[model samples]
Target: MKEFRAAVEAGDFEGLGELLAEDVVFRSPVAFKPYEGKPIVAAILRGVGRVFTEFRYVRELADADGGGSALVFETVVDGVSVNGIDLIRTNDAGLVSELTVMVRPLSGANALATAMSAQFDQIVAEASGASS
Candidate 1:
């Protein structure tokens, strides 16, 4: 989680992509569909980099489930803070294969939720382009 957080907070998409399994899937409450594969993950991370000025991983709990982990973090957007958790599952090869993220703001959960949305279209567009 720390390594992944470092790459993400640094906006190192290239390096981040290298960390994912090709069949990776990222899920969130805001989106009905899982953000499938690396392209979609990159797009969402791109949008996250745009919305959050600062993102840091705080805590993590691991080795507790069917080969999965949970990561907690704080992100700052326009100076306000928000908390997020990523429930991630990895394949037997130890490569991350799935991620489910839940984010709540300290002072602006609703606004953050709205803003966090409105990016699915971009995600879809990126995924489409990648598949082409």
Candidate 2:
């Protein structure tokens, strides 16, 4: 998960993409369905980059076998204070196979949902464009 942290901290979206499995799954805190596949997940991450401000990871808890991890983070969305955790799991190839995001405070989550909703079209476009 060191690579994941480095990529996020550096704001390196391409690097982040390289760390994902082709069939990676993303579970969002506000979404009902889990988004699957690398392209969509990468696009979602990019959309998140646009929505969140002052994002920073505060702590990390990893399995001793390096199979999974939980990264604690803090950020702000439209001035709403947000606390979150990124639950990541790796596949046999050592690339991220699954990522589940959990956020706290109803206000913060609502703010995030609203902000992401505004960019949903653009995110889908990017994912489709990337696939094409």
Best by TM-score: 2
Q: Which residue segments of model 2 deviate by more than 4 Å?
A: 130-132
RMSD of each: 3.1, 1.7
Please give the lDDT score at residue 12 for candidate 1: 83
lDDT of 2 by residue, 60-81 (tens): 9999998999999999999999
The per-candidate count of clashes, in order, stands at 0, 0
Looking at model 1, the pairs that clash are: none
* Alpha-carbon shift of residue 5 in model 2 (angstroms): 0.8
Each model's lDDT: 0.72, 0.92
Model 1, span 56-92: residue lDDT tens: 7778798755578788888776567888888878888
Model 1 global lDDT (CA atoms, 0 to 1): 0.72
| Per-model TM-score on C-alpha atoms | 0.77, 0.95
